[model samples]
Target chain A: MILTDLRGRYQFGFGRFMERDYDDIPGTYPLDSRTYRKGYHVNMFLMSLNDAECRDKFAEDEQAYLDTFRMTEDQKSAVLDRRFLDLLKLGANVYYAFKLISFDRQPPQVMYGQMAEPRLTFDEFQQMMIDGGRPIDGNRSVEEWKDG
Target chain B: MAKLIAGMGTSHVPGLGAAMDNGKTQEPYWKQLFEGLEPLRAWHRANTPDVNIIVYNDHATEFSLDSYSTFTVGVGENFEPADEGWGPRQVPSMSGYPDLAWHIVESAMAEEFDLAVHASMDLDHGFTVPLSIAYGQPKEWPAAVVPVCVNVIQHPLPTALRCYKLGQAIGRAVASFPEQINVGIWGTGGLSHQLGGERVGVVNPEFDQKFLDNLSRDPLANTRISHTEFMREAGCEGVEMIMWNVMRGALEDDVDEVFRLYHIPVSATAYGAIILENK
Candidate 1:
């Protein structure tokens, strides 16, 4: 069923930007209308990090700063935990979630590492990237990986 | 009349911008990438345009998700570099070419392409990194700019074909301008590197190289590459390559491909750069 939902997102576009279910693509979280609607508040909170004053406040009291936004409990927890993939599942766009990463002065690779399948440490992620990146073979779709 | 002399396509990875600002271009990690770009820098020195039309996407830095516009052009006289969490990079503010910008906007609208015009836009890495790569750390950029922002963040992004057609309209708009000026259009970002979900370190060199070839030789075919294929083959973020179509569409059908560079995993992206001039 989850696979169907992912696959459906990409199924219905008429050579234009129509809403389609694309969950079957596996390992990709496209910011469709559904995710956009769900993750709006969390993303808004993330976007706030663009301002210096907001960054100072966020750095001063992380929880209190996050509490000001009307994000869901899952969104808040995911953000607080630095659970990047969970934040995405909770509707946080990676670009917005990146604001939080940027605020912490961590390179984006840290978040990329955390978001990797089987999760990589920063060093492992860098090494994988150096080794010509994760191969697209067997990684295209859920069914491809399953069959492989 | 102003002539469209060249078009460029390159990845505008934020890390590349950071590398330039921090004087880390020669660091072991970034040395190869910088070395690959020397030819491009030399090319820029030889044929610097009077004005550059930069087509890029804002990454929720300058504009929040609260209200994101699909297609926007900057008409402001100057644009400040946006502070994307880390303090804004210490780069010179870009001078906006209002006359040319307004001309393109009016001409595009007249041609039935609806475009949002912003008098104020904080230029992000998507806008600045390309300049840095081409011109290095200049006190002020040699060329004035017209920023064309595309929506790649939210869903319902403008299709590849739509972006291409818009570029053609912009090309007509630029050519019709009465000033004797040289103009360069650049499409920045992408070359496959997914940053989200379980596919973080993905970079398809095969797809990235082929994309460059098709973009140079068979761009109309690229206009038909669906969003699904971009995600499935090039990674989700690879969809950003649609903006490159805008640069291609603005140039003549047959272009002289002068310089091309393809490198893997600058941070997480397969950095691809090309300079094409209309033949």
Candidate 2:
């Protein structure tokens, strides 16, 4: 009987981040990818200090740690503006992003680019990725198309 | 006297078969992918007249991680399609040859294999993928399949030599059957690719090629490769290649290599297919 091994051809990942223009400010703290997308220019600020010790000190007085970060009225308003703290409290999407990054090790990016679009369903995205820039046969049902 | 016709070794990578069902083969990039199987298809039509007793792993679909058996055989009339997140594939469910299947089960037991016999089960992609490739989705497939599902997913899985000996038992059982039938044994899964955890995309093409070559010439020698070494050289999942030794042990020392196909696609796994006929 015929046997064919088909592995390592398609990659799957999350959509690209939306790019936007941000005004450059001197001495501004670098932002992590997660916080940067949320319009927070906050830096770790405590990079110069021992992170564990600072965290322990902060644990003693939480409000003092919050007041330590110097912020302008506009920055404070923006931070509170979108319920950003509440969202941060909801926890980071490390699992989701990790799954996306896993795609990096798969096949080339072009094979799965169409799947990166937000509009497609997971199955449709999988099908589109597998199609790999080819037209799907109109006649075959989803089940028919899948049978070996 | 009924004799062993051929022995085949293959990778029953779930994603490879899943890709076919997912319409991956129709893509231009994958056009060359399915073409590799043409020779095997031709060989099957010309020479493989009856059923192939497929040796494969269940990937924890039929047998959960809670408890795992080393080896299981299907002696049931029909097998259900497993729900592997995407539900079952659209095809006629396989009907077992209970008489033939039970005979082998009994024979293997008598021979000290301690095989678990299943009266009812839904075979996962591991069993079905090779079946689909060997025998297309015919209204009724020519061969009456007797599935021998191995447990490779769980730790303390069957040893390479153990699977090889099981194959020898299978050969004896097939030969003892009252009805004369042209039977072939198939061993599926692995030629090096890891599909889990941080080391997911690992591939060892060199080891895979060597394993296939050694399998054809000196299967016993190939079976000597340890599970630890197999995992180290072929990746953790590569340990599944042990199943091939089972098919190899069933055949003569030197078999004619009919066809061999190897491909590595987007799934971060290595795919291999080989058919060897008795010289």
Model 1 Cα shift for residue B225 (angstroms): 0.4
True contacts kept of each: 0.84, 0.00
Top candidate (lDDT): 1
Q: Give candidate 2 regions above 4 Å deviation.
A: A1-148
lDDT of 1 by residue, B1-279 (tens): 999999999999999988998899899999988998999999999999999999999998877667878899999999999998788889999999999999999999999998999998898899999999999999999999999999987877899999999999999999999999999999999989788999777888888888899988998988998888888888899999999999999999999999999998788898999999998
Point out where model 1 deviates above 4 Å: A1-21
For model 1, the DockQ equals 0.67
lDDT of each: 0.90, 0.61
Q: Give candidate 2's TM-score.
A: 0.65
lDDT by residue for model 2 (A55-79), tens: 4544465445536655334443422
